[model samples]
Target: MKDLLIRSATEADFNAMWDIFHTHVAEGETYAFEPGISREEGYDYWFAPRASTFVAVQTLAPHDRRGRERVLGMCKLQPNQVGRGAHVANASYMVSPYAQGVGIGHMLGEHSIGEARRLGYLAMQFNYVVSTNEVAIHLWKRLGFAIVGTLPKAYRHRRLGYVDAYVMYRLLDDPARWPLPEPAPEEDD
Candidate 1:
């Protein structure tokens, strides 16, 4: 297997990023975004308006692979909002279908948390996570994120009607002082 790397994105990465993003969004199972959103719009969403975006690439030795390395995954991070909410960070992630099951999403998620801490964010918040995305939900939960809130029947899922949406949060207090918060207890009806 080749070594994976995460780095800040540049203009050269937009096309590959679009391909990766479109592949996932077209499935309509995870992200709430429209399938037919234009490239220009996606560009603005990922790179232009966001604080930063990153691409994950697999590196090869001089004669290790058939061709040059290529991007396999990407992540976009930005402030949840301006003013009072500036201390919180938000991000979106996408991994190429070819790269799934290889832990690319996990790697990207971990890297984003580190980057968010380095950028001085008090906490990382995911505003609208579709509960049907069990892989992501499980991963985030294991990574110490709490499902702070659940909007019951908030998502209009294609197969499952009125699925819940979640607000997942992880507080990255300080690298030296990892303040692990206790998990919120599950409630029973």
Candidate 2:
């Protein structure tokens, strides 16, 4: 219906971003974050200015009645750790229910991958994805993320009791196209 732009997030976006995050977290299927967590806490986590956050904003097209853009989704790319692990980017994405059934998530995810590579990340990893979120899981799999690890009964879902969680990883580079060295053989052998 309109043109969508993915742009860097700012403090002005905190309220809009929290609305989406809180709604999704309250659903108890996608993320491990506590739903009752306060707005301040959500702000601290999602609006960490030091990290990379992006918003999918819908702008009016020519002959449109709306004058301003509306935020449809938000995405954040954070470091998995401080030093050595910083080369890997970890991301979380949320799309407003009003924006569902559209391609907002896919657009945000694709934009995030390009941003990660441009930011010099060697790889991207989703540390804890609930197995029950089939939509997101399927999307990630289609996007080339491999299920590298799984934890049994890792998440304490409110109504579902316990559920499995996954660690998904995707190397940003194509190793086959740019080969690296094989490991040296052990002398004891």
Candidate 3:
């Protein structure tokens, strides 16, 4: 995964972003967005005028005609709500199927958290994460998000019929709200 860089996404990256986003949506396992989402719809959702969209690019350069690096994944960070709830950030991520399981998601999660804090969000909340998505559940927990709540039979999973959904949350700026876990004898890092 060397030379993989995370940066602000531009309109030039939309096609690659759409490819990854479409693949996930069409799978109907994780995100709740409808299948066969149109490009215009995808653009409006993922690249809304004010959304903070980002991409992970492999910089070794099998460049597109525009001479941009290949996009391996994408994510968007934005206010979880408007007005009263705007202090909480919300984000969604999509990694190319070819790049899954190689720590790209983790990289994106870490960067998103930092970016959220930098953008002055007091906390981050994932409103609806399908309970069946174990890889994402594990990564979000490791990244310091807590399952703050769960809605029973919340998602109509494409293959699994009905499944629960979780509301994962983490405080970005309030140290008083952060839990103080005891140190482990052995740490992954």
lDDT of 3 by residue, 113-179 (tens): 9999898888999999999999999999999999999999989999998999999999887777644
lDDT of 2 by residue, 42-112 (tens): 98887775588899988756457764667899999988778867878999889988998788988988999
Candidate 1, residues 1-189, lDDT tens digits: the string is: 367789998888788888988888888778887899999888888885657789898765546766356789998889998977777899899999998888888899999999998987888999999999999999889878999999898887867778999999988885467545569899999
* TM-score versus the correct structure, for each prediction: 0.85, 0.86, 0.88
Cα lDDT listed for each candidate: 0.85, 0.86, 0.91
Q: Candidate order by TM-score, highest to lowest?
A: 3, 2, 1
Candidate 3: segments with Cα more than 4 A from true spot: 62-67, 175-189
Candidate 2 worst ten-residue window by lDDT: 174-183
RMSD of each: 8.5, 4.6, 9.9
**C-alpha root-mean-square deviation, candidate 1:** 8.5
Number of the top candidate by lDDT? Answer: 3
Model 3, C-alpha of 117: deviation from truth (Å): 0.8
Cα error of candidate 2 at position 81, Å: 1.9
Q: Which stretches of candidate 2 lie over 4 Å from their true place?
A: 60-67, 175-189
